[model samples]
Target: MGKFDDLPETRRKGLEKMEEVYGFDMSDGEGDFFRYTADHLFADIWNRPGLSNRDRRLFLIGMLVGQRANDVLGIQVPAALKNGELDEDALRELVILACHYDGWPNGSRMNAVVEDAIGKAKRAAGS
Candidate 1:
């Protein structure tokens, strides 16, 4: 059997939700960090119904920019675009808004990241 075959139902749901959010399979992730990310973060927190995925994504983008988490942003921005959670214009606007509150330096970095993600997403989509 596969390593994840015996995972609990919550883990399974988390994997599914991760795939949906990131637009890619997550079942191959291993180790405790991956497990908790799937089980706790994805399944429990992300699956909560109070906010839509887009809402959470916007919030996360702001937080990432504020934290200068460009590495994570590199992953999330692309996923948000691929999932149709946010479009190029919306992401551009978000960079302005988030940077306005966060800071100019962070905004500049985020703008570059956002543009790179847009280029990659467009290339991937053949757009």
Candidate 2:
């Protein structure tokens, strides 16, 4: 059997959820960080029923901006766009609102990241 065949149910669900959330395959991830990320973050946290994926993405975007987590935003912004969690206009508006609350420096950085992600997505889609 392959490595994933015997994974605990949570881990398997996490892997599936991670792919859905990130718009990419997550089956090859390794190490403890990857395990916890897939198992706990994705499976338990993201899959929680109260919030829709788009709602979660909006909250996460604000949190990332507040924390000035540009690198993670690079990953998340594109994934949000790709997964239809947020469109380019909505992302731009989100940055505007986030900037007011999180400050311009972080918002500025996030704005650039969001624009870049949108550009890349548009190009990839041949739009």
Candidate 3:
């Protein structure tokens, strides 16, 4: 089977768009894991089978929620929305679920972050 490089031109363009909209450096910042994440996080893991990009975003949000990464969610939740992969309610569910795992305090913070992300995305889309 083909890897990420074998995807359609449109998909590749989407990936490039993600880099721009999400402000990620596809190039590694002079470290092994950094390069690995940059190269494979999208090109490999995100290109997996049996799941849509929306599914990938859902999983990513779940992981981020469980990890209590609200601080970074400011960027990432909006990034997921920019990828056309997340909706407001689904994002809210991620935050709500986080309360069960990461505690209500962290969930509250994530909720705020997700709200900001949704607002930012809506504004960017001029909606």
Q: Give a tens-digit lDDT track for model 2, residues 1-127.
A: 6455678888888988888899987774789998889889998999999999889988888888888889998988999999988888899998898889888888889899999998898799995
Which residue pairs clash in candidate 1?
none
TM-score of 1: 0.89
Q: Residues 17-119, candidate 1, lDDT per residue (tens digit)? A: 8888888766647899988899999989999999999999988988888888999999899999999999999999988987788788888999999999999
Candidate 2 residue-pair clash tally: 0
lDDT (Cα atoms) of all candidates against the true structure: 0.88, 0.88, 0.68
Badly placed stretches (over 4 Å) of model 3 are: 1-31
Residue range with the least summed lDDT across 10 consecutive positions in model 1: 1-10
TM-score for each prediction?
A: 0.89, 0.89, 0.65
The order of the candidates by TM-score, greatest first, is: 1, 2, 3
What is the per-residue lDDT of model 3 for residues 1-127, given as tens digits with 9 covering 90 to 100? 4233565554454455457547564422446665455456655666668987666666766777777676666667887777666778877888788887878988888888988888877797896
**Stretches of candidate 1 above 4 Å error?**
1-6
